[model samples]
Target: ELAPRGYIAEGWLNAVRTREDAYPTGLAMPAANIAIPHTDPGFVAKPYIAVVKPAAPVTFNAMAGMGAPVPAQIVINLGIAEPGGQVEALQALMNIFMDTDAAADVLGQTTPQGMVDAIRRHF
Candidate 1:
C-alpha cells in the first residue's frame, strides 16, 4: 500500500525483513501479540505507519525474549525517515500495549477507518 503512494523506497521491504531477522520487534501483550517491523531511514521516502490485522496469527521472533516466538495478529509496518522517529512511535505503541483495554480496542477493529480510530484513541 505504501509503495504505490511513494512512502517507501524500492528496497524498503527487503531492508525491513533483514532488520527484523537481526532485531525482532514482536511484543507479547495481554490483549494480543503484535509486531512492529521497521528499518533505517534510508529505505523510507516519507514517514508513515501501516497496520495489518491478519486473518490468522503470524509467527514473529520476540523483541526482548531472546528469539522466543510470538504469534502476532497485529502487525505494524513503520516507514520512518528521521533518525529518532521510530523511538517516539515505539513509545506510543508501548503505551497502548501496556493497556489491555487499548490493545483490545485496536485489535477489535475490522475496517481500516475503524483501526485508525482505535489507534488514534490511544496513539
Candidate 2:
C-alpha cells in the first residue's frame, strides 16, 4: 500500500524482512501481541506507518526475548526517513501498546480505515 504512494523503495519489503530477522520487534502487550517491523532509513522514500491486522496470527520473534516466538495479531510497519525519528516513533508506539485502553481501541477496529482512525485518535 505504501509503495504505490511513493513511501518506500523497490526493495523495502525485502529489507524489512531481513532486518526483522536480525532485530525482532515483537512485543507482548496486555491488550494484544504486536510486531513493529522496519528497516533502515535508506529504503524509505517518505515516512509512513502501515498498520495491518492479519486474518490469522503471524509468528514473530520477540524483540528482547532472545528469539522467543510471539504470535502477533497486529503488525505496524514503520517507514521512517531518519534514524532519530525511528526511536521517537517506537517510543510513541510503545506508549500506546502499554496502555490497555488505547491498544484495545486500536485492536477493536475491523476495517483498515477504522484502524487508522483509532491509531490517529490515540496517537
Candidate 3:
C-alpha cells in the first residue's frame, strides 16, 4: 500500500532499521543539541533508505559510545519522501561528516543558522 502522496510503506520501515546502524552513521543528541539524519525511500534496495534519528542522545555501541543528537531548535522529522533518492542523500551526508573539523563545528554551533550553514557547505 501507499499514501495519497505516493509515500511508500515498506521503504519507511526499512529506513528505520537502516538508521539503527550506528558505526556507519550514528549520532547522539547532546544535552542541548538535536539533529535528525534521514534519507529518501528510493535508497532502499529492499524497502527504504538507511536513515535514523535519535530522540535523546543515544549511547550507540557499534558506532562508538554517544552519537550526536538533533538541534534542540530544529524540528527533526523522519520519513522517506522519495523512492530511490536516499542513497545519494545519505552518501552526501556521510561525506560531509568525514571532515573531523567540520563535523566538530557543526555539532558545536550555538545557533540554528550556524548549524545549517555548516551543513550547506557540505553540499
| Top-lDDT structure, candidate number | 1
Model 1 residue 67 CA deviation (Å) reads 5.9
Candidate 1 backbone overlaps, count: 0
lDDT score, candidate 1: 0.90
In model 2, the clashing pairs are: none
lDDT of each: 0.90, 0.89, 0.45
Question: Per-residue lDDT of 32-85 in model 3, one digit per residue for the tens?
Answer: 233344545453333322222333454333224444432232223235455665
Better of 1 and 2 by lDDT: 1
Estimate the TM-score of every prediction: 0.94, 0.93, 0.45
Tell me how many clashing residue pairs each candidate has: 0, 0, 17
Candidate 1 C-alpha lDDT tens digits along 1-123: 888898998898889999999999998876778899999999999888899999999999999665579999899998889998899999898789789899889988999999989999999
Ranking by TM-score: 1, 2, 3
C-alpha lDDT of residue 4 in model 3: 40
What candidate 3 gets wrong by more than 4 Å, as runs, is: 1-56, 61-80
Predicted structure 2, TM vs. truth: 0.93
Per-prediction RMSD in angstroms? Answer: 1.2, 1.3, 7.7
What lDDT score goes with residue 34 in model 3? 30
Best by TM-score: 1
